[model samples]
Target: MQRTPNWSLQQLPDMDMGQFRQWQALLEERTGVCVSDQRKTFLQTSLCARMREQQMDDYQTYYDYVTQGPLGAIEWSALIERLTVRETSFMRHRASFDCVARYLHERLSQPGRQTPLQLWSVGCASGEEAYSLAIVVEQALIDTGSSKRDYGIWATDISLQALEQGRAAHYPTGRLGGLTQAERNTWLTDTPDGRHAVLPSLRERVCFSRMNILELAQAPLRDLDIIFCQNLLIYFRRWRRRDLLNLLAKRLAPGGMLVVGLGEIVDWNNPLLERVPDDRVQAYVRRDSSESLE
Candidate 1:
């Protein structure tokens, strides 16, 4: 009987400059994530981890295997989950959420607002951001006396693994520190396993889906009232970042809001988007049709 190799003890081969470039090109082409020289070790470790599981010893051979047919496509999907960064937490950026809360208050205050709010949480990892948004929106509705207003949140990410976690809506108690006692009592329930689960009512309002940011043009979402796309654009090249922002801007409803990470992109101006002029947050509002005409 042939014994299986002990991958845990085996040393992974060092990824040479040429091999790194090939993998880099492939990642950029497939996902628009540009791996820099400083991140070579990060890329190597991520690739070697997957390679070891397949019992593949050579980088070039593994690269070829990942670029071929149906199997390659499936392998690529697994590989991307390892490569992409999914670090996130509830209310990670308080200022950004505060900005969103203010926007919701103003919008909900407007009379004769009959349509349900449509919000998107782009690159929402493990549902924290999406759930946090729900908390803010729910509070805003109640505070503004619009508790009967309808709304829905679309949470999307490229990693199906992350999306699965989002749908599960269960998080360790440590991750719930950001929630105030009142908020926690209102929105979360304790699980027997010591984790906190999102209450059913809030969970029902969030829809999780897998989406590759590179295929934004093919996305069916349009006329969105608010889009939270934070901590996601830093992976792409500068030009690609601009292109992604432009696509997001086009999807916003007139007078809608788009909030991005502070200092993620500079000198990126869109004719249809006007900066919100709040130094505390990096946000923009879509110019109303009549305002654009003027």
Candidate 2:
């Protein structure tokens, strides 16, 4: 739409007719995501590089080549990698941590098995959400005489490259402004300037990897107790949303919990989930999940 000649490898210009629609359909079919009309130009701009790399003139050909050609899998991976946004920051939506802490407090107070608390941060961008959850877990550790239950954190994203950035746990100083000086002292290694490195022990607490919600059906998440699939549904269409909700519901453990972003209301009424309160922080609990912060 902008008709800019110069573009990045990810930006595609002079879009071929039906090209956007073709890719849109493929995205929907493959990922259950729909590229809104307003965002179409953005996708085009983002995909120019793939076009250039593949030596293609327009999107239709690119889509065909990317989907059905021998190198289709690689191109498709790149397509999904570039199109899906992964912007995130430390302590994104502070309220979520309070909710997690509250849930853990109430759950652990009761008679429960002493296994590592399993938590998932789906669509976790740059690993901040997982680390933020680690902060909560570290705070929630009981000071009892001999309590040493492990805490497990899995941070997953669609972008393999982004996962690399997250696994490194390296962040610029300015982006860490949200941490108090004292908090930084505890959670990070202070550098000469404001920059800090997340403590290696804390970094070791998280496992970052690549995953696809589209592949949720075949993926195994049988033992997960809490899932944070935040701000991820906005990319998808309705039928796809319903399909994903079904998979999300099925993947959750009987008493596990699902914590989506605040105000995300795609399939809230799905029979598999029930609305619950963690003090004032609202989230969905699996219908049979008995875990609660009372």
Candidate 3:
């Protein structure tokens, strides 16, 4: 009798287009996930590695494993963790922060206009963007003796794992370069291991959550403020982008600011937002008022 040899998933054939489409649909349905054709390479590498780890010869077996309940949930969780890109570093864009600094200066310089300084660091991957916002807010406070004012910051992302890392608020040495000399002196301590630690003071100011923009229709955010929903809409289908923009309009305070990534579009003539001075930044001021939300 001939013996049948067992092969790991890596030894199996490449994913056929049909298998890819099925997996894509199932993933989107599972989490409103959307992957561009450009990311096919990323999908293959991550999924295949997990399949091979199970000693499965093909995707069907791997798919079965994930659909098998509790154990499957664990596998799927791991898969999602690997698939998502958590690429971020401090102060990735100097221009945006500069804008923020200028805006806060104007606000704080005026009397009777200061209250709890609220800002949203939307898509704050790995905590850097959130920290950056904290720094900006802090500088404004110090300059105006407004440090005693409470700050409301909500940093949210679709990946729970990414949010976990952000909550930790520690970074390797290279990531520290994103901070300026004065910022480092105030908010960070150099670790012996060539890493930098974000002081608890700065970290505590930010509230982190696992939130999908699509599911944030009920997020308890309202009134006049600043929103930094940056660099996150690149993956959405066109229709979804419009849906998100409309939703954002409702949340923005009248004369409040909405800052989108360079990749985002608000169709400035869309009747909801008036374009700010800088066209490329996609900054807009809301036309809605608190009376409308009520």
TM for every model, in the order presented, reads: 0.94, 0.84, 0.86
**Candidate 2 C-alpha error for residue 29, in Å:** 1.8
TM-score of 1: 0.94
| lDDT at residue 175 of model 2 (Cα atoms) | 59
> Candidate 2: where is the Cα deviation over 4 Å?
1-12, 53-55, 142-146, 177-181, 191-195, 278-281, 287-294
Candidate 2 per-residue C-alpha lDDT over 1-294 given as tens digits, one digit per residue, 9 for 90 to 100: 123344544334555547777777777887766887777777776777556565565666666677776678887887777777667777777677677667677656657567677888888877878887887777777533228747788888888877887887777865564455665678888667655678887888899878887887776665667887777876776566667666676666666677777655543566777777554454766766433221
Candidate 1, position 161, lDDT: 92
Weakest ten-residue segment in model 1 by summed lDDT: 1-10
lDDT of 3 by residue, 1-294 (tens): 122234442343478888788788767766666876777777777786666566665676777778788999888877877766567777777677777777778767777774677788877878888898888888888887874757878898877788888888878867764678888889888888777888888888999987767686787887647888777876666677777776777776666677777656544344667776864466777765433653
Winner on lDDT between 2 and 3 is 3
Model 1: per-residue Cα lDDT over 56-174, one tens digit each: 87888888888999998999999999999577888888899999999999999998998999999999978899999999999999999885849999999999999999899999977
For each candidate, the alpha-carbon lDDT, in order, equals 0.90, 0.71, 0.74
Q: Give the per-residue Cα lDDT of candidate 2 at 113.
A: 60
Using TM-score, rank the candidates from best to worst: 1, 3, 2
Best by TM-score: 1
